[model samples]
Target: MKVEQNADLPKTTHCNKSRRNLTEEEKEARRIRRVLANRESARQTIRRRQ
Candidate 1:
């Protein structure tokens, strides 16, 4: 009637580090640029609405 609990946590890992989000400086810069562009576009949209 008693159920045994899982003692070991399931391993969730990628075999290669490349599979993870290991962005370099250039990639990080690109991400920031995209975020800034999105924010600017949103502001422009709000201005057009008003």
Candidate 2:
């Protein structure tokens, strides 16, 4: 039996523009979002466990 290889697969993408650093406000917003997501996840877990 013979196996075929994918030659057109890309190893990495070439991003022309580098990512910029997030400011303090953006960081705070991200933190708030994370907290809310975690809270909802915990609620769902508790409901499932009950």
Candidate 3:
């Protein structure tokens, strides 16, 4: 008898298709802006403490 390993398991169709959907550039831009804002806030805090 042959044994099937975990790696041979079948994947769901949804899993294969879902990854095709990606975030838009506008959404990415917004995310970057939020990160920069947080960094700037942290810098201000350190400067104020000094």
Candidate 4:
């Protein structure tokens, strides 16, 4: 019999679905995090263009 390798496995997640069930505060925190991340990305783009 030959042996099988499962070294590379894909992850199955339901985190995004569960996140939708979070409270308002948690959703707001995520929004804030995304806003901050976007702001930093914009700053980097401006610096690169300069």
Best by lDDT: 2
Candidate 1: tens digits of C-alpha lDDT, residues 1-50: 22122212223354565565544985666666666666666777898999
How well does candidate 4 score on lDDT at residue 24? 83
Model 4 misplaced stretches (Cα beyond 4 Å): 1-20
Q: Model 4: per-residue lDDT, tens digit, 1-50?
A: 22123212212354555444657896676666666666666777898999
TM-scores, all models, native as reference:
0.52, 0.61, 0.50, 0.61
Q: What is the per-residue lDDT of model 2 for residues 1-50, given as tens digits with 9 covering 90 to 100?
A: 11123222332356344756657896776666666666666777898999
Total backbone clashes of model 3?
0
TM-score for candidate 2, residues paired by index: 0.61
CA lDDT scores, all candidates in order: 0.55, 0.57, 0.55, 0.55
Choose 2 or 3, whichever is better by lDDT: 2
Q: Which ten residues in a row have the lowest lDDT in candidate 2?
A: 1-10
Ranking by lDDT: 2, 3, 4, 1
Scored against the true structure, residue 2 in model 4 reaches a CA lDDT of: 20
